[model samples]
Target chain A: MVYLHDGSFEGILSGIYKMFHAKAKIDEGKLYEASVYQQSFFELTLNVETERENAHRVASSIYESFGHEGFKYVYYAYLAEDDSYGTLLFRSLKQAYKIGHQAFDALGVEDIRLLTQMANKVSRESHLLLGLLRFVKLENGIYYAPFEPTQNVISILAQHFEERLADQVWVIHDTKRGIGAFYDKTQYHLAPLNSFESLQYARDEVAFQSLWKDYVKHIAIEARRNLPLQRQHMPKKYWQFLTEMK
Target chain B: MEIYEKLRILADAAKYDVSCSSSGHQRGNANKQLGSTAAAGICHSWSEDGRCISLLKILYTNQCIYNCAYCVNRSSNDVKRAAFTPEEVVSLTINFYRRNYIEGLFLSSGIIKSPNHTMEQLIEVVKKLRTREGFNGYIHLKGIPGADESLINEAGLYVDRMSYNLELPTTKGLRLLAPDKERKQIIMPMQQVRDQMIAHRDMKKHLKSTPSFIPAGQSTQMIVGATDETDYHIIKIAEAMYRRLALKRVYYSAFVPGSTHPAVVERGRPPLNREHRIYQADWLLRFYGFKADEILTPDQPQLDLLLDPKCQWALNHMAYFPMEVNRVSYGALLRIPGIGVTSARRIVNARRFSALAYDDLKGIGVVLKRAKYFITCNGKYCGDGDVEPVYLRQKLLEPPKPEQLTLYQTHPEVFDESEATIRGLLT
Candidate 1:
């Protein structure tokens, strides 16, 4: 039997909860929103609606039974937008339920390896974005930064910026996702911000940006120009929002 | 001059220092502060030259009294000079930091009036940033040679890291290039910083709220390819400083000829390849647990440009190779070519469940092309027949084709065979 989810973490967890209760031989499953679902057919297709209570129970069970590391791998793997990741996590969680924490120790298993790989990619992209995200001061004294990360990493990256820039009001908008993590001086919340027209940068923002561009240009030693190495560290995909790159 | 012009002049003068790391300091933000430092530093941007820009690296003033022959800001040189006031420095640091352009400020200076006066001016900017501005970001202050010990101690309280550049590795080289500077003057302040850090750590063990002192520890820079000092001499000094002074890092800057001094001008531009080799050897010393003498012997005073220090060491000690991957310890795994600290740890972790084959080693992060010659999986060798040292050296040192280079340049994500083979050997 195959189950489908609405491409959300809760939806995926609800599918896992149903799969656990049914105890039927599962063939394959995926996010219904993915384009691949339209080309293929399955015998039984149940649309798993997101259930908050069932999702919470499965999340807590994963943590309680397999430990935090296993839960982290599943969570980060779900955040990875790979189409195969949903099925990979479902199978991995089933194995986790049976073997407990030792499921991750079975490196020979294909599902376990793919789950770890997807999670690693998500974690790597999030960490890189933490360093590459640039902010500009707005006229209202709030710092506004925009990033289009490859993964759904805004939720993770927001916590880092909150601790580092605690005194300032800021917004980290994921342009691709159309969602922004807004941080007032005290707390942070996520909201959709489709339009960027509301941002009014400070008058001296241009001057400060020029100063930074000048500093970056002068700081680089002219004799040792390596474009390949530069691109290796700061990939071309992240050049859009970088003030120095502009 | 305008502030932007001053920034260009001062940053250009300060570019040769090459210490841009903002790590090791874990400064949490106070209630009203605007910034904080992570335990592991963040690189805000990388320049075209592939250097990390973690700090607002600039000099407070470029007007100097000392006539250092190799320095761009030497008093005799006919170049533009500029100085920033304490207020201007503080403003630029906080503003640049807020815009996410830099992690913090790395403030160095040329001797404007005296060592004490210049040190005091640097301290004032940091003091104002911490106390009045409530900025809790990383700050790396340069210690002036011959400055009073009390002044150095005072500056240590405000900054995260401090350094006194030992521009020349040997004392004789110091006298030739920078006649006014002495080796003792530089080493004295480093010793003071080290001792104070030890005392602070001891105090923190007993008291819950002992304020941090130089929480990031001290680092120093040495100009490579300037003097006639061999790699042997330089690495010896670095190793000794790491052991004796408890220095966090020892940066190496290749000497760029900026002055018309006969000694510097005669030896054109410094070879960057030599500097790169030293950095690789330095990594082996710090992280790979290799010693100075082990990297270079008395007969061979320099590193091999063809192969990296690690590969060269592995080739020299061929008897240790062809070990089973599933049974080797983590320390022994690190000594293998194409196996770094990360891959070694991964191999140790992944091997607990199932034995790793040559193909499995690739997934575990080990670069198999290079490791094929050095390692085995379940007592099976995957390398080509005839494991001769001369043949392996030639195979590793062969250069890649231009088309392959361009392919790697265009699509860096796609693994080019030649580039990976070379990187596996070099890095």
Candidate 2:
């Protein structure tokens, strides 16, 4: 059997809720996003609509029974963009509910191991982007930064910038997906980007960027130039948004 | 001078002082403040040499009043010198921070006029950034030796971390290389910062509103290989500093040939590997329960460049090897060469449910190739048949060659799980 739902955390949770209520054997079941569903022979596809109450029940059960760490694994795993992330999370959650919070300690379990690895990838990407994301000052005095992270991590990255840059108006745009987190001093909200038009930078933006680039160049000692080490730390994938790299 | 020229010269001069961390402070943003600091520091970029660019590490001025044999900014050295005004420093910090270029400022300076005067100028930059501009970012200041106790104490209230460079490890080295600076001058301010931090913590027990005093604690830098001090001597001093002064970090800088003085010119550039070994031994002192004496003895004064200190220590103490992985405590697990703090915890927690096999150790984040010689899981060992010290040393000395990438595979990020595991084990 195949279950389909909208590509949201709530949709996945509701699917899990329906799976349990129907008492269906999940050994041969597969989960897929509604937007990318593909039918196969002898597979029964069931569309699961997101129900707020059911999603809340599953989320609260996981939080109350498995503790915060368990919820964190689920949260990060949901952000992973892999095709099999849903099935992986489902299998892990099934084991976690049986063994309680100790399920995370079961690194030997294959399902739990795969779930944590996916979660770790999402978290690692978010942390790296936190440092790699560079903001430019827009002409209207707002800081605008755009990035293309492999994982869907804008929601995680937004909370960090909201706290660190509290007094500034900023927008952290995920260019791959047409969405961004807009912050205006007091509040932050996620909104869809209408267009990918680049903003006009402030007059002194070029000067400050040049100064930063110059500092980066001068700070390195020529006698100890390790391009491989530098590339290892700041990967080429992140160099696109870094001003000094340009 | 233009700000661009000042930045180039000052940054070039400051590149040698390598304390780029902006961690250990957790300051939340205020209503009107422009920034905040996270407890775990954030690196904005990486330089070509692979050092983290966490703060805008720059010198306020490169003009000195004394001649030090090993310093590039010494009075006798012929180098371009520039000084940034208090306003200039403030503007640069705010502008860079606003654009997310750096965490904050790491402001160090050479003595322009006098110790007190230089300390005052450095304080002025931080004070203006905090009060006038309302910027609450991480600031690491260099505490000038021989500066007044009052100035050092006042500066600590505004900054997150401070350091007084112990240019050379021993007093004799200081006397020979930097005659103007004395051991007493450097130790006095470090003692002051340590005492003030203690007093502030005591006061905070009674009063809830006592402001922070060097919230990130103090660190000091020691130039290795310049003075004939052995690794044992350097690690002993660092251990004492950590135990007595409550130091946050003891940075070991390899002596690079910068000064053209006859004394410095005689000593060629020190190998960077020596500096790397000192750092590994320093880590054993800080995080792991290993002591300086345990890492290196009087007879074995130098660290083995080919093998890590922990692995070397394990090879020396072969009697304690082949311990049961499931039975050892967390501390004992850390003494293993390949098991770090994180993996040790993972092992301890994961083993509660079932016995860990040799293959299970890898999933728990242990480096099997290194730990195989030292640990056994469920009475099964996968290491070589002959665990002799000489043979094991020969086997471990062969560093793994870098794997060639294929056309489809891309270079992995530094924080990739495998890289992070290797770094955690080594560091």
Candidate 3:
């Protein structure tokens, strides 16, 4: 048996909810996102429609059984850029149903270990983007930041900024994924936005950016020039939105 | 001067002080707040020199009254000089912070008229950022030597961390390089700050809303290769400071030749390797539970350039090798060359469920190549039944595969401590 989801966190959980209810005995790797479902040995497949209530019920049950850290790992693992995340997360949750919180523990198990690895990678990338994400002030006084993260971590970064910069209105755009998280002064929501090529900057945006570039150029000690070390900390792929790098 | 030109001049002058940490401060945002500091900090960008630009690390003013020979902002230097007004500094901080260009402000300055006056100017910027601008972000204010105790106390209230750079390790080096700055003057402020932090923490234990005073604690920076102090002297001083003063961190910066003074330049290249080794040794002191004397003795003070301090210590003290992975205590597991704090803890936890064989070690995040030689799996040795120091040293220095050494070079991050040292992430 195979279960296909819509490649969203809720979609994966909702699909898992159906799998748990039916108790269908299935082979390994029988679960995947609908977009990534390749023709494998499995013959029977079902595209599980996303059920918001079912997803919420499954998530709360995991939170109740596996603890908060386990709940976070499930979400972060789903956010990681891996095709096996859906299958592994579903299997781990199934294992969690029996073993309780010990499912996140028991690193010797392959499914739990791989799921933990993905969650750690996604969490680490989100933390890095929190710092590396650069913001530009728009003419309308909204703080607009755009970056292309390897993982689907725009929501994590958005939630961080929604608290850190609560009073200021901001928009965080994922250039590669064509999605943006917009926050008003009161609350925040996610929306699709691809047209960020043309932006009206505040009057002093270019001036402050130039000043930042000048400061970066001068603050670096001339004798201690190590581009390789610089790349190791701030990888090359993240330089596009960096005003100083530009 | 224009703000652009002033920023360049002031930032260039302030680049010599190499304390860029923005971690260990946890301040939550209030209602409709503009900023909040994270305990695990956020590094906005890495500079060309490969250092983190956590804060807007600029001097409040480069106009100095004292002519310190090793300082770029020295009164005797012919370089460009600039000073920022209170409004200019406040505006730059708020704007840069809003754009996510920096974590917060790292405001240091050259001595102006008096130490008290210079300290006041630095405090004013931070106070305006906190009270007037409503910023709860991290603020690392550099303390002015010879400043009054009252001023240091007041500044500690508004800032997250503070430091007074000792520059050189020994008092003799201070006398030679920076004649105006005294060792006692620098040490006094550190002592006072440490006392205040202790009192604040004690008060917080009783009252929840005591209003944190330097919640991030104090850290100091020392120039490594400038003076004639060896790694032993520098590490010893760092250990003492960490022990006696309870300093959060002690940053070491290698001397950048040909930039500051004519007499200061001894070689074309700075002693970067030596500086890195000292940082690793310092890591062993702080985290790895190794003593300063254990790292270096007076007879053989120089750390091995090729091997890390932990590996060197493991080689020199061979009696502690072949530690049983399943049965050895967590502290003993940390003594293994390749094992870190994370791996050691993981091994302890994983061992509870099942005995960790050599095959299972990799699953628990152990770097097997480095740990295999020193650690054992259920009393089975990975290298050989018998340990030979000379052979082990040679084998460790050689690349994993001889042929691949020609085809590719291993990244510096392959080893953990050295990477932390160079990247300034040694917390």
Kindly report which residue stretches of model 1 are placed more than 4 angstroms away from their true locations once superposed: A24-36, A65-68, A96-108, B30-32, B398-427
Per-candidate count of clashing residue pairs (backbone under 3 Å): 0, 0, 0
Query: What is candidate 1's lDDT per residue for B168-270, written digit by digit as tens?
Result: 9999999999998999999999999999999989999999698789999999999888778899888989999899999999999888765668656455666
In model 2, pairs of residues that clash are none
Question: B85, model 1: CA deviation in Å?
Answer: 0.8
What TM-score does prediction 3 earn? 0.93
Error of 1 at B376 (Å): 0.4
Error of 2 at B363 (Å): 1.9
Q: Could you say which candidate leads in TM-score?
A: 2
Pairs with backbone N, CA or C atoms under 3 Å apart (clashes), candidate 1: none
Candidate 3 C-alpha lDDT tens digits along A76-98: 88888688877787777766576
TM-score of each: 0.93, 0.94, 0.93
DockQ scores of the candidates: 0.56, 0.58, 0.65
**Best-to-worst ranking by lDDT:** 2, 3, 1
* Candidate lDDT values, in order: 0.86, 0.88, 0.86
**Each candidate's fnat:** 0.67, 0.70, 0.76
The ten-residue window of minimal lDDT in model 2 chain B covers B406-415
